[model samples]
Every structure is written in structure tokens, then in C-alpha cells.
Target: MKLPSEFIEKMERLLEDEASRFFSTYHEEKANGLRFNPLKIDRETFLTLVPFALSPVPFCPTGFYYDAHEQPGKHPYHAAGLYYIQEPSAMFVAEVLKPNPGEFVLDLCAAPGGKTTQLAAMMKNQGLIIANEIHPKRVKALSENIERFGITNALVTNETPEKLAKYFPGFFDKILVDAPCSGEGMFRKDEEAVQFWSQAHVEQCAIKQRHILDCAYEMLKEGGILVYSTCTFSPEENEQTIEAFLQTYDDLELLSIEKVHGIQPGRREWTNTNFEEMERTARLWPHSLKGEGHFVAKIKKTGPSPSWNGRYAKPNASKQMVREYRQFEQEVLQTEIEKPMYAFQHHLFALPDHCPNFDGLKVVRAGLHLGEAKKQRFEPNHALALSLKPQDVRYSLDLSSDSVECLKYLRGETIQTGEDRGWLLVTVDGYPLGWGKEVKGMVKNFYPKGLRIN
Candidate 1:
């Protein structure tokens, strides 16, 4: 747990009296947390259902503190999209934005989809949210998490901030820029962060964050709410970056973040010019809270944004594809898919409401992936199964969370179902896990092979 000597020296100089308290936190075990998905389950129901000993994260209602000894990731409920394992402090970033249902939103720099999922849940999966991650490799995980959370209204993209800004100018009602930074906050949990820490790296991250914020600003409409957050505790990437952003845009106003439950305000003295209004931003110190370090700043755009002249995405599914899918839907699903259907070659998707044309962007996933059109029949995607409830489907096979059948289903093993149901929704404790096709007395496992446990 050795920290960089330069970082230690900088912190000691910066904290003065509080350096001892801050340094002592490194000896403590890192906290583990998971947020129950309110989109799938309620808070009270989740509390009673979970086996692990838990405590609520004061700042986030859905967030719970789990013991380091517990392995919730291995549970079937996790596969059922009941909850999302996330850092407690990281959960607060989405809470600050709080995008309402039907409002267009953007999560700039979203990867691994923690904040993006939370934002989508807050929006009740009604609004269109574009979760953009710059890196090609990281965008895969972001798309997977969005699907696992039963989020139907997200458009996952792998594109640079500059590219996205050109397509979505003044399109979003709310935006979140959880900028990449020097991993000062994650040093305790990740050894790589400790090795990567440097003052020069912090400065580089600050520059990158400012550019990302600029792109986010262009996408936000007038009276839009934009929240910027970082995992690092460095003032250069925190107070200083926000100060520079506010200074650059006279139309942006820093809004006060409620500093409750061990959260503190950004230090005014940390900036180059000692920006006093930097106090409006919030900081989650490891020593002061039950979570890792984080800095958050919420702002409002007062100036009018240019009208977006982008074209709305059109339904591209052919008549034959629609006919095949509709035939399957009538036979398999109890509920009708009322949204516009889109086609990507043989694959089919239900486009989110008011979805803009993603003609040039590298789209990882667009809206709810319905399924793939195979020959004369249509096969449902695993995403379609995860997004459904027991009542949504015509037939289902429910297995207990602790049952051997549940584990077998997750492992991509065929199970024996006495009934000869064609397309059956597989569930763990009444929660949809994935799809299974039953023929004769044997159920063919449709749980995605990539996600199947060994």
C-alpha cells in the first residue's frame, strides 16, 4: 500500500492539518458496494431478498454497502439484473444529474456503464440516452451493462466527444461527463492506479476533461443540467478543471451540491486564481466517507443553445422481416412491442423514442435489440429476454435462486421441461434471466455463451 512519494508530499502540503487523517485511511480495507436496480425490483423487496448483510449508502438510496467477504457477482440474481455492483461514491454522480423520464440525455465518456445505468433507471427507461465511450475496447462493457440492467432506451456508441458533438448539438436536456482522470481515488482498491499516479498525469487529465466538458456543453440545450465528476481527488482535475470550464463559458452557472453524509465542498484555494464559487462542487473524501474519493460539480446552461437539425431515425425493417417477427411475437410474447422496428442486416432492433440518425457514429447498440431474423423464423436476442417480465411472455420456466437448475441455466446447459413450449423465458425467482427454446421435453439453452459461467 505504498503511495508515491511525490503524491504524499503534495497531499501533506495541501492538507496541512488533515494529512495524518487522510493517510491513515490507506491501511483500512476498501469498501464494496452494489446498487439495487429499481427498474427491475423495489428497494424494500431487494433488502428482504438479498442474502448478504448490508447497510444503506446514505447519499444513494438504492446503493448498499456489502462486506468484502461476500461474492454477490456469483449469484443468479446478478444475472437477473436485480442489482449492479458499483462504487458507493461513484453512485452519487448519477444522483446529481437526476434526468427525468422522456428527457433526452447524454453520458459523455461513459464506460463500464455505472453512471449511465443509474441515469437510465432515473429516467425510467422512457427517454433516449446516448452513452458514448471514446475507447473501442471499453464501449463493449458499457453496452453489456446497459442490456443487463434491462435498459431499453439507451443508444450505446463508441465515438469521440468531438464527433458526437457535431451530430448532437443542442439535443440533450441533461448530460453527465464522468471524465477520465488520474486514479488517485482508486489507489486503495487498484494497484495500477498507485503505479500510474503522477503530477504530470493529473495535468494531462485536466486538459482532457476540459475538452470533454466543452463537447458536452455543445450537446446540452438551454436550461439543461450538466454534471461533471471524477474519481481522482487531485485539485488539478477537480476544482481547477471546473473553474476553467466556468471561466470559459459565461453562460454556465455552477449550482450548489448538497453536502450531506460526510460530503464536503471543493476547496477554493486549490485553483490557480482561488475561484471562490468552486465551493459549489462536492468532494467525497475516503477518510470522511464510507467510500473512495470523488469530486462532483453540477451546472446549468443559462444561454440558448442552437437548434439541432439532425434527422430522426427511420424504421428500416423490411416487410418480410416484420412479418416474421410479428408472427413470432404473437406466438411467444403476451405483450406487443409498440416501438418502431429497425433492421441491421439480419438483426432487428426496436428504436428508442425520438432516436436521432446514427448514420456515421460507431453504434455498439441501438435501443432494444429485439432479435435476429433467421431464414423463415425469428430468433430472440438475450437482451430481449432480460428486458421482459414473467407476464410479458406466453410461457416461462421459473427456478429458485439456490436451485441446481438455476446454476445450470446460467452455465448454458440444457434443462428438461415437461411442457413443449417453443420460446420460453427462463427466470430465477420470477426475474427474467434469459431465453430458452423448449422442444419435445428438452429446453435448449439460449443464455449467451459469452456470459455463461464456467
Candidate 2:
């Protein structure tokens, strides 16, 4: 738990008296947290069903503090996407954004999708959310987390901020720029972050964040809300960054963020210009709060920007593909998918409401991936299973969380169920885990191999 000299020197000058409390936190164990997916399960029900010692995070209603000793990540419920394991303070970012249902939201720099999932839940899986990650490799993890959370309205993409600005200018109603920064705040949770720490890196991050923010601003509609946040405490990446953004854009207004639950305000003195309105930003210090550090700033687009003029995604499924899918839907699903269905070669997807065409964009996933249509048959995807309720399916195989069969299913192993039901929705205590197809008495495991617990 050795602190870096440069980091210590910079912080001591910034804090003066409070530096000791902030540095003392480095010796403490990192905070552990999990936020229940409201789309999958309610908070009260989740508390009753889960097997763990948990306490609620005061800042975030959905977030719960799990003991560091607990291995909730290995639990079958995790595979089922019942809850997302996230850092406690990191969960607060989405709460500040507070995206409502039926809104077009953008999660700029979304990787490993903690905030994206939370924003999806807040949106109630209704609106369009583009979770963009610049890194090609990290976007896969973001896409996977989006699937596990049963997010039906997200379009996972791997593209630069500049690229997205071109396609979605003035389109999104709300946006989250969870800007990448020097991992000053997360050093406790990830020791690697401490090793990577340097003053030079912090300056680079500040420059990069400004560039990312400029792109995010372009996509937000006039009068739209945009939340900028970071996991680091560096003034260059926090108060200073927000001040610079405000200075650059005359139309942007720094909106007040309610400071509760031991949260503090941004120091105006930290900024080069000593921007007075910078105090509207909120800071979650580890010493002040029960969680690790974070900084958030909510802003509104006051000036007019050109509205997006793009074609909405049309139903492109062939007549034969439609007929085949409809037949399967009739036989297996009790609910109807009334949304626009699009096809990419043999793969079928139910397009989200008001989804725009992502032509030429590097889309990793587009809306709810229904599955592929091969020949005359349509295979249901694991995403299709996770999004369903027990009643939505014609038949199901329900298993206990700790049952041998549950472990088998998570491990991508098949089981004998003695049922002839086709397209079975496998559940862990009534929450949809994944899909399994029945052939005679053997239920073939369709749990995605990439996600196999093995």
C-alpha cells in the first residue's frame, strides 16, 4: 500500500490538512459492491433471494455493499445477469445521469459497462443507448455485460468519439461521458493503477477527456443533459476539466448536483480560471463517503444544435425469414415481439424504438440480438432467453442457485430433463439464466460458450 511520491506531493498541497485522511484510506481494504438489475429483479426481492451479507449504498438505491470475502462473481445468479458487480462509488455516476425511459442516451467511453447497465436499468430497457468504447478489445467486455443485464435497447459499438459525432449529431436526449483518466481513485481496488500513476499520464488524460467531451457535446440535443464523470481526484481531470469545457462552450451550463451522503463540491481554486460555477460539480472522496473516490458534473446544452436527420432502421427481414421467425415465436413465446426486426445476413435482431441506421459504424451489437435464421429454422439466442420472464416462455427448466444442474448449465453442460418441450427458458429461481433446447429427454445446453464458468 505504498503511495507514490509525486501523487502524495500533489495531493498534500491540494488538501493541506485533509491529506492525511485521504492517504489513510490507502491502507483500508477496497470497497466491494453489486447493483441488482431492476430490469431482472426488484431490490426487495433480490435482498430476500440473495445469499450474502449485504448493506445498501446510501448514494445509490440499487447498489449494495458485499463483503470482500464473498465471491458473488462465481455465483450462478451472476451468470443469469441478476446483478452487476461494480465498485460502490462508480455506481453513483449513473444515478447522477438519471436517464428516463424512452430517451436516447449515449455512454461515451463505456467499457466493461457498469454505468451503461445502470443507465439501461434507469431507462427501463426502453430507449436507445449507444455504449461506445474506443478500444476494440475492451468493447467485447462492454457488449458481454450489456447482454448479461438483459439490455434490449443498447447498441454496443467500437468507434472513436469523433466518428460517433459524425453520425449522431444532436440526437441523444441524455449522455454520459465517463471519461477515462489517471486511475488515482481506483488505486485501492486495482494495485496496477498505482503502478501506472504519474503526473505526465494525468495531463494526457485531461487532454484526451476534453477531446472526448467535445464529441459528446455534439451528439447531445439542444436542452439535453450530459453528465461528465471520472474515478480520479486529480484537479486537471476533474474541476479543471469541467472548467475548461464550460469555457470552450458558451452554450453549456454547469447544473447543480445535490451534495448528499458525505459528498463534497468541486473547489473553484483548483481551476486555472477559478471558475465559480465549478462548485456545482460533486466529488465523492473515500474519506468522506463509505465508497471509493469519484467526481461528477452535470451539464445542460443551452444553445441550439442541428437536430439529427437520419433514417430510422426499417424492418429488413425477408418474407421467408419473417414467416419462419413468426412460426417459432407462435410456438415458443407467449409474448409478441412487435418491434422492427432487422437482419444481417442470417442473423435477426429486434431493433429498439426509434433506432437509427448505424450504417458504416463499427457496431459490435445492434439492439436485442434475436438469433440467427438458418434454412427454415430460427435458433433463439442466449440474449433472447435472458430477456424473457418464466410466463413469457411456453416451458422452462427452473433450478436452485446452488443445485448441481444449475452449475452444469453455467458450465455449459447438458442435462436430462425428461421433457419434450422445445426452446426451454432455463431459470435460476424464476430469473431467466439462459436457453436450452430439448431433443427427446436430453436438454442441450445453449448457454454461451464464451461465458462458460469453466
Candidate 3:
């Protein structure tokens, strides 16, 4: 738990009288939190269903604080897209830039999808949200979380902010740049942040954040909201960076963020010119709250922007593939997929509403992946199963959360259903777990291999 000597010195200078309280928090156990998915279950039901003792995160209604000893990540409900484990302070970032249903949104630098999932849930999975990450490897985790959340309206991509800006100029109604930082706020949660702490690194992160913000501003339409956030408490990357950004763009205006539940305002004294309007931004200090540190700033674009002329994605699935999928849908699903069907070779996907043509972008996941076309028949993807309710399918095998059968299913073991139902949805406490295919009194597990628990 030893902090960098230079970082300690810097914080002591920054906090002055309050430095003692801030340093003392490091000795205490870090707070843990998770937000229930409203897309799948309601707050009251989730409260009754989950076994862990939980308390509400004051800033976010769906967010809850769990004990450090609890492991909600290992639960079957987690795999069923019931909730997402996240940092309490991190949950507040999406609340600042809450996007409405049917609004086009962008989560620039979205990876491991903590904030993106929250935003999508707020939107009720109705809008088209582009979750973009620059790193190839990180984008995969982002896609998996999006899938696990059963989010059907997100277009997960692996592309640089610069490239995205060029293609989606003035296209988004709202944007979130949860820019990468020096990890000062995440030090308590991740020790690597403490090891990597340096004044030079903070300065470098500030430069990168500003550039990412510039790109995010380009994609946002006139009168659109752009929320910039970081996990670091460094003024160089928070107040000072926002000050420089506001100075650069005349049309940009800093909007006031409601400082509730021990949340503090951005320090104007931390800026180069003592920018008085810096108070509009918000800071979540570890000592002042029940979670790790974070900084958030919401801005509005007042200048006019060119209207986006991008083409909407077209349905490209062949008649044969469609017929096979339709047959599978009729025999298996009680409900039908009415969205535009898109094909990627043998695989098929149900494109999101008003999905744009992602011709050149490195799309990791395009909306809801329907399934794959195999020979004369169609096989459903695990994503398709997770996206459905038990009532949506004809047959299902419901298993209790703590039962050995649930563990067996999660471990990719075949279950003895003793029913000849061709396709069945597997569930844990009435929530869709994954897909299973039945032949003669035996259900072959279709749970994804990579996700199987050993």
C-alpha cells in the first residue's frame, strides 16, 4: 500500500490542510460495487433475488455497494446479464451524460465496457450506441461485456478516435470520452497504477486526453452533450485539461455537474489562470466518498455542425440463409426477429435500428448476433440465447442458482432433460443462461467454451 514519494508530495501540496484525510483512506479496504441491469430485471426484483448484502450507491439508482468479501462476478446471474460489477465512482460517469432512448450515442475509448453498459441500460437498449476502443485486445472484452449485458443496440468497434471522427462527424447526439489517465484514482484498486505514477506520466496522459476530446467534439452534433471523464485525480488531466479545451473551442461551454453525496467541485485554483468556471466539473475523492477517486466534466457544443450523410446499413442475407433462419426461428423461438438481417459469410446478425454502414471500421460485434448458418440448418449463437427471455422460447430447462446442475451446465456438461425438444433455452432462476440442443432424452450443452467455468 506504499504510494510513490513524489505523488505523496504532490497531493500534500494540492490538498494542503485536507491531505491527512486523503492519505488515511489508503489504510481502509477499497469499496466494491455492482449495478443491476434494468434491461433484464427491475430494481426491486434484483434486490430480492441477489443473495449478497447490498447498499445503494447514492449517485446512481441502479448501482449498489457489495462487501469486499463477496464475489458477484462468479455467480450464475452475472452470466445471465443480470448485473455488472463496477466501481461506485465509475458508475457516476454515465449518469452525468444520460442519453435518452433512440438517441445516437458514442462511448469513445470504451473498453471493458463499464460505463458503456450503464449508458446502454439507461437508454433501455433502444438507441444505437457505438462503443469504440483503440486497442485490438481490449475491444474484445468490451464486446463480450456488451454481449453479456444482452445489449442489442450497440455497434462495438476497434478503431482510433481520429478515424472515428473522420467518418462520424456531427453524427452523435451524445458522446462520452472516458479518456485514459495516469490512474491516480485507480491506485487503490490497481497497484500497477501506484508503480506507474509519475509527474511526467500525468503530463503525457493530459496530452492524450485532450487529443481524444478534440476527436469526440468532432463527432458530436450541434447542441449535443459530450461528457469527459478520467479515473485520475491529477489536476493536469482534469481541471487544467478542461480549461485548455474550453480555451481552444469558442463554441464549447462547460455545464455544471450536480455535486451530490460528498462529490466536490473542480478546483479553480488548480487551473493555470484560476479559471472560475472550473467549478462546473465534478470530482469524486476517495476520502470524501465510499469509492475510489474520479473526475468528470460535461460540456455542450453550441456551434453549428454539418449534417451527417452516412448511409444506413442494408440487409444482405441471402434468401436461402433467411429461409433457414426463419425455419429455426419458427421451430425454436416463440417470437420473431423483425430487424434487418445481415450476413457475414456463414454467420448472421440482426442489425440495430438505424445502424450505419460500417464499411471500413473494424467492427468487433455488429448489434445482436443471430447465429451461424450451418449446411441446411441454422444454429443459434449464445448471444441470441442471452438476449432472450424464457417465454420467448418454446422449451427451457430451469436450474436453481446453487444447484450442482447449474454448475454442471456452466462447466459445459450435458444435462439429462429426457425431452425431445430440438432447441431449448437454459435458465438459472428464470433468466436465460445459454442455448442447449436436445436429441433423444439428452441435452447437449451449447454454452460457449471460452466462458465455461472449470
**C-alpha lDDT score of every prediction, in listed order:** 0.94, 0.92, 0.94
Candidate 3 lDDT, 273-322, residue by residue in tens: 99999999999999999989899999999999878999999999999999
**Where does the lowest 10-residue lDDT sum fall in candidate 2?**
417-426
State which candidate, 1 or 2, has the greater TM-score. Answer: 1
RMSD to native for every prediction? Answer: 0.7, 1.0, 0.7
Better of 2 and 3 by lDDT: 3
Model number with the top lDDT: 3
Residue pairs clashing, model 1: none
Candidate order, lDDT descending: 3, 1, 2
Q: Model 3 misses residue 207 by how many Å? A: 0.7
TM-score of 3: 0.99
184: Cα error in model 3, Å: 0.7
For 266-344, candidate 1 gives per-residue lDDT tens digits of 9999998988899989999998999988999999999999999989999999999999999999999999998889999
Off by over 4 Å in 2: none
Please list the residue runs of candidate 1 whose C-alpha ends up more than 4 Å from where it truly belongs after superposition: none
lDDT of 1 at 127: 80
